[model samples]
Target: MLDNFPFYLGLLIIILLLIMLANKIKVAYPVLLVLAGLAISFFPGVPVIKIDPELIFFIFLPPLLYEAAWTVSWKQMWRWRRIITSFAFIVVFVSAFSVAIVANYFIPGFSLALGFVLGAIVSPPDAVSAGAILKFVKVPKTLSSILEGESLLNDASSLIIFRFAMIAVATEQFIFYKAAISFSWMVFGGVAIGLLIGWLFMKAHKYLPTDANLDIFLSLLTPYIIYLAAEEVHSSGVLAVVSCGLLLSNNRHRFLSSKSRLQSLNVWESLCFILNGLVFMLIGLDLPEITKGLEETSLMTAIGYGVLITFVLIISRIISSYGAVIVTLIARNFITVADNRNPGYKTPFILGWTGMRGVVSLAAALSIPVYLNNGNGFPQRNLILFITFIVILLTLLIQGLTLPYFIKKIKLNDIYDPVPRHEAANHLKQELAEFVLDYLKTNYEGQTEHNPSLQHLIQKWEQHIKGIDNEIISQDHKHIYLDLIIQQRKWLINKNKEDQTLDESIIRRQMHYLDIEEEKLRYI
Candidate 1:
């Protein structure tokens, strides 16, 4: 570990520079990181980073999945459950089988089971990639929510298929009934374990002392604990982490202190940024190593196969997405009780186009055994790895870069502007303010002497409420109030920079508080 320190440090520095470049150029950071990694791969003496499949599945996947689960809005997820489930489960199966058939037909010496294994490897659009890319582009809230939800759930489905396909390939046998039973057990058991762990942790938070540091530490441990426990029982650890995160996130206000929430947010954001950056870059770095073992297949043939498979993957997803939409439409016509909100052609098109693969696919491909039970080499393992890498590279380069342009062309950002949401948010705040004021006046009108701070806070809340109400009635006042808050925040930041006597942390804390206030004014 110590020997690798310089290498790790150098890689991190490169990641940082790439991130800065990405931001400056207004491009997705992952795309830039991958490009940087690919360029560095050709440099003399740059060592190939061989990623262990176990490390990815065990170490990297849990926290990333949990963080996504925690941040996803449960309400929105539930609202879009039908669409999400269709994409997560049905589309995964469709894509897997479609890829399997196509691969078996097109690629020489590729068996159906081997094709299914490749299908499983590439089936799920990675949660991290989609989230990272979408963060930079403004899309419809429903579109974003559905994509997130699909990514969260699809891993479990794809991994299940991958496991069974691996078993079938190794043993040369496939049992549908046994696979179905195993799948059910894994899904339900994983969810049960996650709920239990989440509940236990929630109780611990409530009973334990309200120490923000300790709370943050426990929050970090939650995902790993859930994942390991579920995996130990042969369950879907991915679903376990996701479920635990969703449960805790939904109930965060009940147990987490304000400081814990604030600290945890900052910690998770930074952690995710570093992890995602390193993962994407590593994907590119591993390309050289992945391509080196293809002795039997020529590079030209491999490239042709890769290009053909990538096309099949994209087309399969597009067809499945539209087919699901049509099925939903037809079902709604027949059933009285169904979600009536129809996501038009544009939404499905975007969804189809956003199916970018990432690290998990590479990891799954790498995890394929080097040899079968009979001691013969695993059929086309090197070729599978190469194709997987090619798919990831092309999708990240082609789909990831083009998605922003498509969003703009469709006017998704303009359609889902935050203005209407802001108005609704302000209206809700106004009602909440009125209720709080009424409660305070009813209970503490004659107790101002006993609680001066309470009275002052009440006054501040009242003023804020009035200001928002005024802004709603008069549009010009909105800009005026927003500008004042912005100026105040800038003044505080500049003052903090100039003041040598003040502690930096103190200044930062005040700035953060001001930021919350400013965001509220600007958005609400």
Candidate 2:
């Protein structure tokens, strides 16, 4: 471990540099990190990095999924439940079986079960990757919410299918009824365990002393505990973590102290950044190890297989997305209580196009057994790993890089304008100010000791109300004030983009100040 210190330190430095470069070039940092890791793999003195599948499933996955779930809006998730569920479960099943059939027909010795394994491996798109890219490009909130909700839950379905596939491959038996029962149990049990754990944790936080540091520490531990507890009972640990996160996040405003909430956000954000960078880079570094023993299959042949399967995966997603929309439209006629907000064609197209695979796919591929129960070697194991890696690389490079352009071409940003947001915020502020002034005047006007303070507070609230009501000065002055702040923020962002000399921390600090100023203006 001590001997690896220099290497780890150097890796951290490289990740930082790659992130800066990504910001300058307006590309997602994960893409750059993967490229950097791939480049570093060929360095003369560097040792090959092997990814531990267990580490990813047990360590990295829980927290990442939990953090994502925590940040997602539960209200939006409810509104888009039908769309999200269709994408998460139905689309995953469709994509998996579709790829399975294609892989079985195309690859010489690949069994149908193994094909399903590969399908399951590549079925779910990485939420982290999508979230990171979406952060830079402005998409509609509904689209973002749908993508986020689908990603949060799809892993459970994918992994469940993967488990059944692995069992079928190893035992040479498939039991459909038993598998269906087990799937339901896993999902429902996971949710029950998660809600129980989340409720217990919520009680603890509510009753405990309000120590920000302690609360943050507990927040970090929540995911791991929830995951382990659920998995111990053979339940879906992924669902458990996600459920726990959503429950806690939904209740955070009521139970958590303000300082704890702020500190926890900062802590989680930093942790996510480091983990995401490391995971993507690790994906690239593992390429050398994954390709080591592929002497049986020619590289070109494997590449051909990968390209075919990648095409299949993309096409399957596109078809499934539209199919889902059509099915929803038909079902809406019968189910009157369903979400009636039709997402239209463009949204589904964008959603289908964003199905880029990431680290989880690689981890699942790597986890494939080396030997079967009959003591024979796992058929085409190395080739499967190789193909999986190729799919990851192709999708990340091809789909991830071009998704923003597609969003722009569709004019999604323009469609989801911020004018309504500003209007609603201003309206809320005016109503709040008016309510406060009315309460003060009615309750405290006759009190002698509180008269002066009450009058002063009432005047302040009235002045704010008047300022909001004053249309002539309000519109022009507010616009100028907002414009100046926005201009300064843009300059800082552009400086960071143009010259890589400025530290990202400086830009982040400046951006934070601008955000605060903009937030303050919402009241006026």
Poorly placed runs, candidate 1 (over 4 Å): 336-339, 413-419, 448-458, 468-524
Question: What C-alpha lDDT, on a 0 to 100 scale, does residue 59 get in candidate 1?
Answer: 80
Give the whole-model CA lDDT for all candidates, comma-separated. 0.80, 0.81
Measured with C-alpha atoms, the lDDT of residue 415 in candidate 2 is: 46
TM-scores vs. true structure, each candidate: 0.87, 0.87
Q: Count the backbone clashes (under 3 Å) in each candidate.
A: 0, 0
Indicate the worst ten consecutive residues by lDDT in candidate 2.
Answer: 468-477
Error of 2 at 258 (Å): 0.6
Q: For model 2, which pairs clash?
A: none
